[model samples]
Target chain A: MSAPLLSVKDLRVVFSVGGTLSRLRGHVTAIEGVAGVSFDIAKGETFALVGESGSGKTTLARTLNGLQKVASGSIHFDGKDATSMGRAEMKELRRRAPMMFQDPVGSLSPRLDVRALLAEPFRIHGMSDRDLDAEVRRLLTLVGLPVDFASRYPHQLSGGQARRVGVARAVALDPQLIIADEPTAGLDVSVQGEVLNLLNDLRDRLGLSMLIITHNLHVVRQIADRTAVMYLGRFVEMGETEAIFRSPAHPYTAALLSANPEPDPDRVHDRIKLPPEVPSVMARPSGCEFHTRCPFAQDLCRRNAPPLRVNGGHQLTCHFPMNTPAQAGLEQAQ
Target chain B: MSSIRGSRGAEMTMTTDQNTPAPALDIDALSVSFATDGGTLHALKDVSFSVPKGRITGIVGESGCGKSTLINAILGLLADNGEVTGGAIRLGESADITKLTPRQMRDLRGLQISTVFQDPMGALNPVLSVGKQMRDIQYRSNLSKREKDARSVEMLRQVRIPDPEKRLTQYPHEFSGGMKQRVAIAMALMMRPQLLIADEPTTALDATLEVATIELLKELQQEIGCAVLFISHHLGVIAELCDDMIVMYAGEVVEQGSVRQIFRNPSHPYTRALLDCDPARLHERVKHLPTIPGTLPDLRNRPKGCVFQARCALAKPECGQPVTSVEVTPGHIARCIRTNEVTA
Candidate 1:
């Protein structure tokens, strides 16, 4: 395969809690939001990150976009060293890879009309010398919105319309990569289908690589080529979307898949109900982070951290990985 | 007016079965309108459904589909601008909720019908401890403070909260999101009301926590034997947790039937489209998903005949005239003129 469009290696992000007073009193503590996670997105491919809130999926996405400070590890985009980029290089990177936030209406400036919002991206990157009006029309047409909608403000547009405007803005600079966080949230089922179709169409048309961060498994299955399951700032499982859904190797991944309620009354809902409490990042669990919630957890899981085991394209971190008898037998023999 | 009365009288006679008890809540041809600047916006137009005794009935609809309005009308908490323009909401034996006095409605609220809202934090008081709030809700009872505390502890235990005795003294902030929702459910059921209305109670929770909450709710509802009016936009949750389901569109109940019947075979164009729109139901990866083309009609100037005519693919010229609901099967109805074609 050709070189990946974007590559992240052992990336980590740490946040320090308490104010300066606490620091002076030697009471400061650090929490690893994204703890040494790595992944790669090929050109025109979509990669998804799925987890509950505070699992550092958003933090990892932000770190990739250079919005959050990376505590360690390296990042490479299009064969360029993103971690060591200077101000000019970083600004160029931002233009080449724009972000789409979660809240559709909240992300866009309420005061700006659709035309102004779409044109703001070009102006920010100092490309205002072009025909801004024609550019705005082109964006509106690209996202399948009417040209008349360009005059409407953020509040005037519906949720799905506002999301279209957001998409138009994200692709305004013709970025090689787009980072979308919960792209289909807060939308009705039909409207969600519209947005997903638009995104899929744009990816194919523009040859864009997308890093989608969402907890919606249906969205992941629909658009993503690869998926990673995050738990307590680490990837418990990563594989092809089809393989992950068909036979999840990690217990956490299985639990998450089974938890999704299917819109079918006949199907037996054999759900693995995890405990409600999510451990705080500040107070990390002793060994396997998911041991407390894993239904198949044993004494070995609590005392020793499992190493990442790779089988073909699939990789998982668990002592007794499901659906692979060879690995389970090897662990048992040990 | 006489025609409206005639239909309501017919419905009453049909539901008056001596063998079976009256439904916990029966809404007959209910209509609600809010006075806005443009005009009187009919939020609910001749809506009718019944929450059967000790059965779970789920209402599924998108925003602006009158789910919230229906809940408010049932609880007598509609805004000042809102009014029940037509029909009656009968609770139990003899109370027509539209005619109830404010004091009587207040008396009926927590004692006969209880509510569990979407946001647990908002439903619960931040200043008071869980135990204090639970005890305070029982002010209408003659039980002593000690008895109330004991009942609160038992309710918490029933909801599977660990260490119910000590957890009761903690503030709302101390509990996790799922735990807070569990506490909210406990408080809503503490009065042992005949009816429990859960408005997207598990929507704010994670997928794992959501399943857990649904199971807990199912267990508790069976134990308490209370009629449940579960309102949510999520088709999956409605299918998983409800015995019967109502599909609302443009402030009208477009379809309703048993959960099995509706899921197995949806008759209405809108209901079929909605069920098809669910990504989970699609087994194969497709380039584009099926979508309803047009937006909802304006409530103030509602379209002439069918509310979903503009967006429906199967709509015809005959749909321009007023369309009566068709009974697809026993207790299964669809408000669409082409139900025969769709079902066939």
Candidate 2:
């Protein structure tokens, strides 16, 4: 794949908890036992990150965008180490690799007009050409927004319009990589599809490599070229889209797939039901992070953490992979 | 279990029966309008559908689609400023919901109908214990305090809450988001009302927890004989839970049909657009989601035509006439001009 557009290796993040409480003086180490996580995204391949909240999906996404300082990791963009970039280099990278947030309005400056908002990214990147107005007009039209909307303020735009402005700003610097975090959250169903389709079209036509962090499996199944399933800060499964969906390699991935809404109504004959909630992030399980609520957990499975291994052209860190019904302790999962 | 598809109406209560005498809840020409600060907002227009005796009827729609209003209208508790301007919801021939007086509607609620609100914390009282909140609904019944407590505990356990005794003693603030939702469902089911209205029950929850909650609801509905009006923005959950379905858009019933008919052969343009955007279909290159691509028209000054016409893809000039729902199938109906044109 000639040096993939983006590559992340051995990423780790931790936060000290209970430090404020003088009596309970200790560190609640988060994201431990997650070692040497590595993945490569092809130039135009859209990679999706799916996991329960607190699975460090957001942690990994933030690390890539340089929003959250890395504890220990190396993020390489276009064969250059993003983690080691200087201030000027980082600023350049920031413009060329802008990020989109979940809440469209939350990320936008409420006071700024749509035209000014789209222009802000260009100005930040020091693109002060006389023809910038024409460029902004092209971007607005590209995102299916009317030109008359440019003078209107952010508050004047609808949720979808705000989202279009956000997209325009992200692509303003002509970034090769776009990292979107739950981009369609809280949008009306009608608007949600439009945004998803736009992202898909952008990836294929613009050749933009995107890292999508979301809990919606349907989103993952739709736009992703490759899928990586995270659990408790570590990726439990990673593989091609078709393979991952056809035969999930990790128990966590299987549970997640089973929980997702399948188009076929009769598909819900047999599948494991999710537990009521996820465990606290501070104190993760001793072994096999997903073993806590796993239907087939045993003493051997709980005693030791499974090594992240590759099988059938995929990376998985589960003792029990979602192979066949009988293999994953499901006579019917077949 | 697949046999239930054939005996759906009889084996389970809510699945519509070809021979059954009465639908669990029959709503006819129901319209809800609000006299808001903006103006008189036409929220729901000419909505009609029936829930089978013991199955789930998912009323799926986006925000401001009058989904909540329809639920409230059925519960006989339309908001202070809102009124059912037209139509009637009948629980057999005896109850005429549109004509019911406040006292009669009050009597009808909790016994004939119950509701589970989306915000567990907001819906629940902070000062009240879980047991007290549950018993409040069942208190008027002949059941004693101990009986109510036992039933409450059983209901909690049925919803898969661990250690019901400890949970009942704790207040709403003490419970987690998923647990609070469970307690709320437990309280609503405690009444054993003939009909249950769940308004966006899992929108505030994580996608995983939301799935488990839907399963619990399906299980509870099966065990109890009440029909469920499961309202949510999630088309996936609606497909999983509903036997018959109502697809609402901008305060109007855009499409109403069986789950199979709606999924495999959606008639209305809005309904077709919704299913097309579904994440399940996202695997391929979707050039355009073909969304009903405009915010719902301001309800106050709603144009005197089809509300979805502003955003609809197959709309014609004549669609400007007042939209009327007609029989699209033996049991399916839709209120759109291009119902036949939408190949979805």
Candidate 3:
């Protein structure tokens, strides 16, 4: 009911390819990394961006965090426009919305101990006047790490422990939003459960909104309130997580869901095996970006780009969506 | 060789069936220790399993579970400081791999036992063409150049790589991740090895490619009739691709059974915990996922009792004593003192 915590509208990030020679010759090529994406995250809501590598999920996250410059459109965070924010405002925005990178150990300074890593955020945000020691201990305890871990360096901690430390640093500023990229990656199954539980617990306890970018659909299914399936830097499907899993509107969403290997051996897995190659962003397919890989693709799909069709909260960009009889019936009525 | 005979005799007595053909690879009471700076780290202890002929046996475990060590021991490529402390790795009919010299092991590696690693780029030569690399893998064979080339093409075709002849000329960089992995698999099966060791071969690929690769592996294994040892940390992949699975915990095989049996009813506390931890197994959204409580025991000074005792929820004071495996059912076993209580 309240205003959304983060609102991104028509966000686009582009990068110029080739060297200065191509620019001098007036033949420079540009690639759209995050091509005109839009989404909103309500307060305390967990939103997930699911796609394979180079699908611009990470780029979009970076753009929101102000790590990457947006070519167009706006990022409104906590009732403030982040795109046009000056240095001080951007610095404040960074404090309120911290980014947790993929590699836990690599992201943390190897030289710094857990205490310093936790304190660094407060110091950067000009909040070092408070008791840093107590704050460090509090963060460690919050993330379910032992208080003794404060003295340990990044290399000393295991993968799961390092990830917890990363979590502690992300929440150090008491941020309203936490953008985690592949939060459970490279962890063992049991450890992954621990990390997920911690994140879930933190979300509930702190009342924080989250934007999770991951290729692991299992994570999305478990944690996300809502999800968006990105293909070639744009969302092919966006809707309630349960609805998306139950009956995917876009063919790409169905393919992704079926492709995830379920742990049960008894369940027959009829995987939608797409053609191996992912089309380059520079040379995206005409019309539907996923038409090349979509098993149900037809002549009409390749001729024109599909509009974002909305039915209730579910949205899809496909010429012929799958597994939504109600939406099909509605379209027929229209 | 004579010293390993007693263990082989013991293994034979344990086998329930006499008519079944000899397993492609039999690892009997195998123990591997690495001389680390801290101490002699026992990476694998009393690890016993059989890769049955023409069947897929998966080894599933997290990091430090010694799956890699077992593979290295089988391939005779353990690090210089690592040693086979005890027991035997009997490959096919005659050889106890631990006793084999470097020369003998090299001769047996490619022809008798081939391996497909996780990263295809690392497995393949970046400078050389795919055709050249595939052809060169058969250097031990007496086949002619043209014959090897033809065999390479056939192998690629079997893996369903489009336009095998044209794709062969392209280098590793030219192929996509899935295609490169396919190429790696084709090359590994080129010799029709008695046993194939795939160490997390599909972990690097996307979800679609991962399932596709799993299906291809299943089809190819059936076609080649070679025993496969599929090692992965993913429970889902192991469940889907393997016929039999060995669940390792802290360098010890905690449970071993048919995939169907294990998935349906896991006997060991560790196995049950691991299965519960998998997000794919959980249908409903829960507030907190079940997690194994503690970290793996230090390898240098492993606990006297069960390796997973500290983390196991069903552990008892009696579990402080060293435990041997208990047969839950025919062909299903768990190495835990509380197996009876838990299974009951």
Clashing residue pairs in candidate 3 are none
Question: TM-score of chain B only, all predictions?
Answer: 0.95, 0.88, 0.95
A1-334: candidate 2 lDDT, tens digit per residue: 3888888888776654444563355555343433446888888888988887557777777777777777787889888999888889888887767889878888889888888888888777777764778978988988889988889997877788889888888877778999899888778766877888788877777889898888887667667888898877778889987677777767677777777665545555456665765666656777876778887787867888988788665888867665765654422232
What TM-score does model 1 achieve against the real structure? 0.94
lDDT (0 to 1) per candidate: 0.88, 0.77, 0.87
Best first by lDDT, ranked:
1, 3, 2
Model 3 CAPRI rating: medium
Tens-place lDDT digits, model 1, residues A227-275: 9999889999998998888777888888888888888887676666688
What DockQ score does model 3 reach against the true complex? Answer: 0.55
Question: Could you tell me which 10 consecutive residues in candidate 2 chain B have the lowest summed lDDT?
Answer: B1-10
Model 1 misplacement above 4 A: A19-28, A324-334, B1-18, B142-146
Rate residue B147 of model 3 by lDDT: 93
List, in order, the clash count of every candidate structure.
Answer: 0, 9, 0
Q: Write the per-residue lDDT of candidate 3 for residues A220-332, one digit (tens) a residue.
A: 87899999999889988999998888777787888888888878788776656698778988788998889899888899889899998989888889888775564342111
Residues B1-344, candidate 3: write the lDDT tens digits. Answer: 00111122353324355566668888888999999889999999888888888889999888889999999999999999999999888888966889989999999988889999999889999999999998888898899999999999999999999899998899999888888999999999998999999999988888888988999999999998999999998888988899998898877888888898788879999888888888887766777888888788999999998888888778789788978677777777788878887777
Error of 3 at A4 (Å): 1.5
Q: Which has the higher TM-score value, candidate number 1 or candidate number 3?
A: 1
Task: Name the top DockQ candidate.
Answer: 3
Superposed by TM-score, candidate 2 places the C-alpha of residue B203 at a distance from the truth, in angstroms, of: 3.6
